[model samples]
Target: MPFTFEPLPIAVAALTFLLAGFVKGVIGLGLPTVAMGLLGAVMEPAQAASLLIVPSLVTNVWQLATGPRFGVLARRLWLMMVGVVVGTLAGTGFMQGGHAEQAATALGVALVAYAVLGLTAIRFAVPPRAEWWLGPVIGVVTGLVTAATGVFVIPAVPYLGALGLTKDELIQALGLSFTVSTVALAAALAGGGTFEAGTAGASALALAPALIGMTMGGWVRGRVSEQMFRRCFFLGLLALGAHLASRTLI
Candidate 1:
């Protein structure tokens, strides 16, 4: 089926993608979750997810390329990557028959949960005993959501953040996640026959807007204070969660 482009929706999508990528560029994560959650109200979840893969890859790669601790990030996250792969598979399978709205609702809840953790200072420190399981859990959750809806990074963020990684490490982890999940999702879409040439071309064309957003966000990063950004980030996540929940529930 040919994708009939209405100018309004495409313009809206491009703008939203730009804002979402900007946030990701500045903060190191939240692009897919924010973008897909918001976009799902207007487009099919699969399409939204597919549309983001290219832009997400670009920003994430740039972030990772600048990281100084690739060796440490790789060692630390090797196990977690396993979990992400599994989660991606499960999510993909689940999405094959699942409702997009349900996934959006779930994504909203997950973001709210993270925001709450940030607000309340609640920490789930991975113990040595449970450390072995953390990777798989992240992987499974990420995979399930990635496959089913394309917005699975929110849950993984707090856990990764808790690793006490420096800003650079965090950037590396986000990059790795974007690369792995993007590839997995693309493969899943191909296997499912949803990967279309025209869609891919459109996604590529839309990359410029996302890049522009990232550039603006980076410029703002130094001028703004960390505390200020944290305030806006959590509040934004909360608002986003509320919007998604309301959309899905109503």
Candidate 2:
């Protein structure tokens, strides 16, 4: 199909990307998660996911490069990456099916769960010996979730947080994981026939606003109390999730 741009959705996509990017700049994550949440409210879940592909890939690549020990981290995470790819491919059928709304609802619930987790001060640790088994498991789960809803959080972020990585390493690891997931997701969407030139164009257009918002957010991060900002951010996510879930249910 040829690309057709609608003024309203384009505006929504631009604004949502900017907001999502701002959140990511301040917090170091939540670009896709926040974008999908807000976009799902207005667009088809698959379309929202499609819109996320370009910006997510580009920013995360930048993130991955700016971090420490890329090769070492990649080597350590190889199995997990493999699992993420395979699982995403396997799960793409859900997004292509008639149950796309269900996927959106699931995304809403996932967002709520993520927000709640963020609000809490819970800490989970993974032992060095356990990474071999846990890594692939978390990867597959994250990939499956991404395939369904275009948001990759849940077990993946938490599991990575459990590993005793330094702050920079954690950020880099997350970027690596998200980058791979974005690529896998784009492939899946293309194969499923849900992403085409039209959506790709919109996704590309959205990149400008997202990058601008990210730059602004980075600047704000230095001025504000991170802890306070995080609290407000999670609270907003909680509300957004509830709203999306309600729409799906009601």
After superposing candidate 2, which stretches have Cα over 4 Å from the reference? 1-3, 98-100, 103-121, 222-250
Query: Per-residue alpha-carbon lDDT of model 2 for 1-250, expressed as tens digits?
Result: 3234778777888899999888777656789877876786677778888889999999888778888789999999888998899889989877657776676677678768877887899756888888898899889988887887787765677677678676567768888999999999999999988789888988899899989988887677657665665576567567656755666665
lDDT (C-alpha, whole model) for all candidates? 0.71, 0.79
- Models 1 onward score TM values of 0.88, 0.86
| lDDT, residue 12, candidate 2 | 83
- How far off is residue 183 in model 1, in Å? 1.5
1-250 in candidate 1: lDDT tens per residue?
Answer: 2233788668877888788878876776667777776666677767777777778777777767777887777777777777777667655545557586677687778778777777776655666566567776776677777787676565677677677665556667778877777777877776666657866776777689888988887777657676665665566677667766677666
Instruction: Quote model 2's TM-score.
Output: 0.86
True-structure lDDT of candidate 1 = 0.71
